[model samples]
Target: MKAPEGADLCFPLLLNNSCRKPVPPQSDGMLVLLSFISLLTAALNLLVIISISHFRQLHSPTNLLILSLALSDLLVGLLLMPVEILSTETCWFLGDLMCALYYVVDFIITSSSVGNMVLISIDRYLAICDPLRYNTTVTLDKTKICVCLCWMYSVLYNSLILMDFLRHPDSHNSCYGECVVVLNHITGSVDFVFTFISPITVIIVLYLRIFMVAVSQAQIMRSHIAAVTQQSSVRVTAKKSEMKAARTLGVVVVVFLICFCPYYSPSLMGEVIEDSSSSSTFVVWLLYFNSCLNPVIYAFFYPWFRKSIKLIVTLKILQPGSCDAKIL
Candidate 1:
């Protein structure tokens, strides 16, 4: 696999003329496993989204936002992951046109996931801090607007990649014929800002505010309950519920950081170390892990989801030969 001719000097060292080689066979098994996991996770999340949408009881604004997020993850896992796995395995079997489409879909889904986290954080903050105004402030219309703005902003941010690709198609250094959006240092810096830095800043700030609100609400609720209820069991139960909610949110935040840090850290480091292969196969897999993490995290931290799964399983057992299936 020869590097493309007359590529720009700004291309990463890995894409330089001397670095091109046959696809490594060492990681084929890992790629296949990751691809399979991504496919299964995507399927499960899609089922959850569909089940929640079909049931009117799960129609709250928070669940609606979660369903949207699950859809985005599903798109990433279903459309992008297989292509990525193929590229890693066989050195970009897809042609240029398909690669470009993959790039666009990847950008949209990744951006939407980050955007959803920010929106969810804001929702949690309002629900805890401004409970009196949450219903009015986060109405259906407002939620729609917020979701639209997130998608629009993501589209705009990623449009620059298309523009750059169109302007310098010859400069693409990847053997797969994929558009190398961040070819040079300047473009790489811009990509980091748009994809990593900005989103991380927004997510961190929003979660901080959310955590404060949750803590304050828990304190106030405890005080009110203590004054009204003389029963020790009632106070303990209320405290336990509040603690469980806090733990769930904490798990969400931690999973976000763990899954995203590897990718973003390399982007930041690339600014200083121009010739690093730090963002290689391992880092790519770490980024891909994020799409699979959310549903598992939700199941681990939320009792409702667990209960729903158990009910579905029991129903399936009772209806032994029935083809009817449902996800909860």
Candidate 2:
């Protein structure tokens, strides 16, 4: 997906331009590989979410937030990825109405994924920073309200993109039946601010506060443990739990930054410079890479997630009186 000449942005292609054209028929192999990976990762995450949800023991606030994020990614895998694949093969072919619908769905799901991240970060912040107040602050009612607001915010943010598309006249295409929007710079700038910049800013600030709280709590816990003789083991266990939470949160924040920075950078550039470049294509693919990275992150960086997967896959470990069996 080289930059369409004169367009503000371009879709990311998996392979470099040198490999894009070849005497052999393997030109599109990289795109297919990426699509396959994205689809598989999305499916696995959905399955994990469903398995956890089906079991009553897994019905905690943290798990609920994970479920919400998985659902958002699942929507992207199902609705957006196929269109992206089609667009890679040929110019969009579903005509004006479907194209508009595609754009809306993409924006909504992508925005929702970011929104879920923000909410999850806040949840973790409260849980770690003020453990006593965590339960009261993140009650079922509050969680539901937060989730609803995330969806509502996504809808409102994407509505502008939809409006921009609708306002522009449809293109009488040369090959594909899809209608492409003449990217309006003003609306594009607004989209960048609302969809990318604001949400990212909020996430960074919340995480910073959460980190400070975690550090303070750890210091207090250490002091209490040093003063106690009998409760040392209990304090040690609590400390370990806190460490795990910190590690998981750290991974989430780092991955979010690395995956999203490239995708959003082009949008920022698009606002200032209307010229389309190959960098835009690169950013699009980088964003697509994000959809698949979460499952790997969970399975590798988070011990609890890895244990849950083990329980699901290996029934041999699920003994008659085991905690694993009880979780199932």
lDDT scores in order? 0.63, 0.63
Model 2 lDDT tens row, 259-303:
777655656667442211112444555665566676566433446
Clashing pairs in 1: none
Instruction: Compute each candidate's TM-score over C-alphas.
Output: 0.77, 0.75
Q: Flag regions of model 1 displaced more than 4 Å.
A: 1-32, 174-179, 221-242, 270-279, 298-328
Quote model 1's TM-score: 0.77
lDDT of 1 by residue, 19-117 (tens): 233354576677668768877868767766754555555567777777777888888778766755665533343444555555666777887888887
Q: Model 2: how far is 188 from its true place, Å?
A: 2.2
User: In model 1, what lDDT does residue 165 have?
Assistant: 57
Candidate 2 Cα errors over 4 Å, as ranges: 1-28, 167-179, 225-250, 270-280, 298-304, 307-325
* Candidate 2 pairs with clashing backbones: 12-281
Q: What are the RMSDs of all candidates, in order?
A: 6.0, 6.9
